[model samples]
Target: MSDSTQLARQVVQALLDAGVREAVLAPGSRNAPLSFALLAADRAGALRLHTRIDERSAGFLALGLARTSGRPVAVSCTSGTAVANLAPAALEAHHEHLPWIAVTADRPLRLRGTSANQTTEQVGLLPRAEVLDLAAGDEVDVPVGALLAARGPVHLNVQFDEPLTPVDDWVPRPTTARPPAPASTPEPKVLARGPRTVVVAGDGAGPAARLLAEQAGWPLLAEPSSGARAGSHAVPAYRVLLGTELAAEVERVVVAGHPTLSRPVARLLGREDVEVVDLAPDDRWQPRPFPVVDSAPVWRVGDGAPDLEWLDRWREAGRSLAARVRALLRAEGDVTPHEVAGVVAGAVGARDLLFVGPSNPVRDLDLMMTPPPVDRSARVVANRGLAGIDGVVSSAIGAALAHGAEGRTIALMGDVTFLHDQGGLVLGPHEPRPNLTLVVVNDDGGSIFSLLEQGGADHAHAFERLFGTPHGVDLAALCAATRTPHWRVESVAELEHALSQPAGGIEVVEVRVRRDNRREIDERVRNLRP
Candidate 1:
């Protein structure tokens, strides 16, 4: 073994010892010495390594691992472009506030800045990060200390001195012990109370996410991505659902880890009487009502805290939508997004739902279907992270891969999102096949725009040009092109039949909803209070 090999092993061992167990690796020769060493360690039961060829994908893969395992996860890449590719993931982590160890391979200081093949100034690249940058020549203790002390992600640029591998029989020193501390429990900091407070759960949240909101002792305002019922337009406190009149007496507002909205919600926090608290990782957007309650692991508020009763109430409220959805599906008897989601909710042994977003589909589902029946067992995931029209397909694919292992994956996305990354559909036929039922609400135009303020104004022409950006794509043909069986439903009966049958491969159901009637459907649904 050589010095480089020894250094890599020591680093890996230190991270594992420090409770960083998962590693997502991207291949590269500059980091070959470390990569091989880490791989060998994994074989030896000293670590766990998940390999991805694309650094971009690998970075997100690492994030998914960390998100699921609830532990800081690390990513390794060989030098050069691979390191740069990790930036998107790093940016996401910075925003999502996930801890990912970005390990980049570098040449010795002498070789860098001389146009060395894989050498560039890799130091302090993530200027916005709460990082502990380390050099390969530095003592193992340095990276170890950084890893142990990291409140968030760190970047480690390793410069392996020539001779790449370290001699065998060398042992890395253990991390130094910390000083003893006072044993008294610190009181939690609580925000000012409100006469009526609502906890907003963003995308990627599950029951655990909702549980956090409940802990704050406030009604939950769930986005489609956040995975909760917006509730009946009538119910007051519980109905703090969409468009509910906010209270003048409410003092504080809390936003959990979800993406910011494209359209603004109530201006309660904007009022002089209200204060806003964001529990997200980064405050870069400087979200309005902008104080941050920076809690670790998860954020909690107040003395009695968010109670189980709130979560239970939320669950029951969700089931109300589910029941209505089921009843509609049973009555309509169709394979539309509504009927399919209805059948899925009934068949679902669990509450885990993977919603795919795009212009037409999610909105249609929102208007037509009730929430899934198994609310407590349900979780909703959407890539509203950036709310881009681009990644809906890939994001859905990723979510299915993440959660489909234990529960059913019912993907409700628009034809555009489906067509956007239909390549992701390839994963379905692979061994250990993903259990995903993709429901593509095939509205020809960009339907979501019609509901926005932008939709009703003179921007109509601009809307068609920018927001609508309609592409005359045929989803049924595309589904067949992928060898995935598809159903074309024009009404409720067809949709019900498509959803009622047992599905083996990835299934795509295209339901044609006219853009003209969307507003009417939305108004009817919103007016239908239980």
Candidate 2:
């Protein structure tokens, strides 16, 4: 038996033993041993395997799987550029503190710096991850230990020699029970309750944020992906309300997770006047960008309850703002991005899984969706760590597949984001398909920029060329190529109907809207006050 084959088999088994339930592979010559081993494991029902042609998409795909399943997912790809393509996902995982194992196959050590093909410093490709560079003779046990201790992303760059294929039919041994990933001990901190405060919950803030708000009787300004966005304390259209007079009265702000969605939230955090108490702590490389008056890894509500009048003010403001925004949207008299987001949000149930892309879609969701009174079981996810439009579709698909067979999965992304990872739709016939409904807001261009400073009247000329890049791609034809079901809706009625009857397997509903009025609508929405 070849050492390459033996190494690959042991690594695969070790990965399984280390709690990797899902594995993503981007095919290449150097990784043939790992691929063969993985395929054999899949055949024997040892773990689920996903295959992607694009290394970038494969990386994000593993990201979704790891996040939704709450399990460490392994993404393996060939040497050099293929390994580098995973940087975006790896960086995101690092910041988000997700357990992602990147198993990169590299050329043998003898090929280093000798003008070898596809061998450009694979060891340090992902600096954010805990990396272990291993050769053919290296022990797999130490690397497996790193995988077990991985709090965030981990990299295993293994070098394999020629004869990458297995010589014998490798039958898998019964794998041991996988251990649970260790949870961080909650750093206890008691926050004094007299000050007028609001709990700001960002992406992955979890239920602690909501519990604190409810217990302390404070308003919850939670972004959609925060998981704490529900409950009675949640304020609808909170971002818009942040500019109101009520927001100015905020004496203190209790923060959790990484809040990066809106400028208003950033402004609130950036305020040197407002004492920002953090619960997320400095988990990643960079500390919190804003001033942290107090820091804790996790928290609970302190001794006394806050004033009810403060909470009531936020509640009334939220209701008023939501009403005003709803009226304004109705007055638009045309199908808009916010309306589409609202329609999609309304379709969410307790058993549903929602994956939102960065940019406009996430913002639209924040503005339009009303949080439920109680915490619904619906899970919302986004790649907000770096907040870039890379591999969103592939990540959503990966999330949906790993989310199990119990509930429907819905993904909201803009046309450009959809185009960014369109290769994710190119699934092979033998690949496992997830029941996913992808809703694309086709504005023909990047509408999110239109709402930014770049869309100002003075910058109109350069905007279209750079920021407002309109791509007139026929999405229906694109969907046709993958044999995926597609629907194009232009009206709220049409959108509601389309969302109701999602084409079961893998489908897309493209809602067409115009970006010319984007800035206008945003300005009007901002002007709204409680």
Candidate 3:
């Protein structure tokens, strides 16, 4: 067999041994050998193969698979701009600590700086990831094994010579599995019981924060993607409360994960009067501008029960705010973005998986998603690292495929976000389709900006053209073009009905609302008092 063919097979076998069950590939001439190897592996039932015409979508699809599966996922593409297209997904994976392996095909060393057809500096294309530059005859076992052992994303740039095709009937050998890494000891820090503390859980915090809060009888301010948002102590209207006088009374804050959603939370952490304790894992820590009094892997409050009165106070305030907000939403008469988010949250059961897009949809979910009841929990995911509104559709599709065969997958996004990665909806006839329901809140444009400073009356002159950027493409027609099922709902009841149906394949349910009331609604919400 040719050197390139042998190297490709070895690399694929190594990935399989590393426990990569899903692989996504983007087509190009340079990566033909790797493509053939991946197909062969799929035929052997070693891994599942997904093919995408767009490298960007393919990268996110792989990211989604890894995110939901809690296992490394491999994504391969040709050289040049195709490798660059994976940058967004790579950055996200690195920040979120997801296991993603990027395999890029490149020309041999002889083609360096020689005006090759699809050549660029592919070695350092993804600076955040550990890049492994390989040639045809180089040993692949060590580098591939190292990448598999690493926690985050890794890039493998392989150089192939003129003949990119594999030799006929070359079968890969069975891979040897490596022993699992040793688990780390949990060093729990003892927190002082005197101070009134609240647990702040951000993206990727998992359930540790929630468990700590429940045990300590402390209020939990968890972002929607935290997975710790449920439970009795979770404060639903934390954003508003953070801006209230009650937040001023906070004596200490225990933080987990990375909180980037609200300015109020940032301000709260910045307060010199309130001490902050961060319980982020060792590998995840980075220096921050805000002061953190203590940092550890786990934190345990000192003996004795926490002040139940303080917890009750915050819980009561949260309940009052939730009731007022619900009344206000009902008073609106027509369906609003907040209502749409609430209905979607209600529809999500313990077995369901939800991927929320960035911007207003995620923020709305943060504000409105009711805490799941006891004996039930839903896995909520969002790409909050850098938090850009790209690749969300493909990411959602990937999450759906990896989540399970029984549970339903739902994606909540705004019109602009949906349009940003509309290519995600395009699936080949032979490709695997997941049971996904995309809930799109269509307000004719970028309504999220309308709630920001850009929507002020003073900037109304430049608002519509610059920020709104309305693309009046009928979403139903867009769904039709992609051959996906589409539904348009205008009321809360209709949205609930739409979500109630079993999701068989990819589909879109568009919820229409007006953008004019966004600023007013936001002001009212922020100014609300218990």
lDDT of 3 at 338: 90
lDDT of 3 by residue, 16-48 (tens): 788788999999999988999999988887789
Q: Give the winner by lDDT: 1 or 2.
A: 2
Candidate 2 residue 38 Cα shift, in angstroms, is: 0.4
- The Cα error of candidate 3 at residue 66, in Å, is 0.7
lDDT of 1 at 178: 39
lDDT of 2 by residue, 1-530 (tens): 78888888888888988877789999999999999999998988989899999999999999999889888899999998999999999998888788898888988888999989887888777968888877676455535666776778899888899888877888678877456566868657778887889999998888989988998999999999999988889999999999988888888999988788899999988887799988666566347788888887766676764688989989888989999998999898889999988888888888889999989999999999899866464788999988999999999999899886878999999999999999999999999999999999999999988888888999998999999888889999999999989999889999888888877888999999988999999999999998
RMSD for all candidates, in order, please.
Answer: 6.6, 1.6, 1.4
Report residue 286 deviation for candidate 1 (angstroms).
5.9
Those runs of model 3 whose alpha carbons end farther than 4 Å from true positions after fitting are: 175-179, 281-285
Tell me the number of clashing residue pairs for each predicted model: 22, 0, 0
User: Which ten-residue region of model 1 has the weakest summed lDDT?
Assistant: 232-241
The lDDT of model 3 is: 0.88
Checking candidate 2 for backbone clashes, the offending pairs are: none
Each model's TM-score, in the order given?
Answer: 0.68, 0.97, 0.97
Q: How do the residues 1-530 of candidate 1 rate in per-residue lDDT, one tens digit apiece?
A: 56677667766776676666667677777787777767776666555666666676666656655544445777898777777777766766665556667887877778878998877777766544554444554455645555655544678777777676545543333433332243554454555443345565455443444554545556655555555443321112122233323243455556665534423334543556655666544453444344443443345455544444544554455446545534543553333344444444444445355554645454443433343333344555544544555544544544555564676767777766666556555532322345667777776767776667777767766877777767888777777776877877787666667766748556777777655555544444444333
lDDT of each: 0.57, 0.88, 0.88
lDDT of 1 at 486: 81
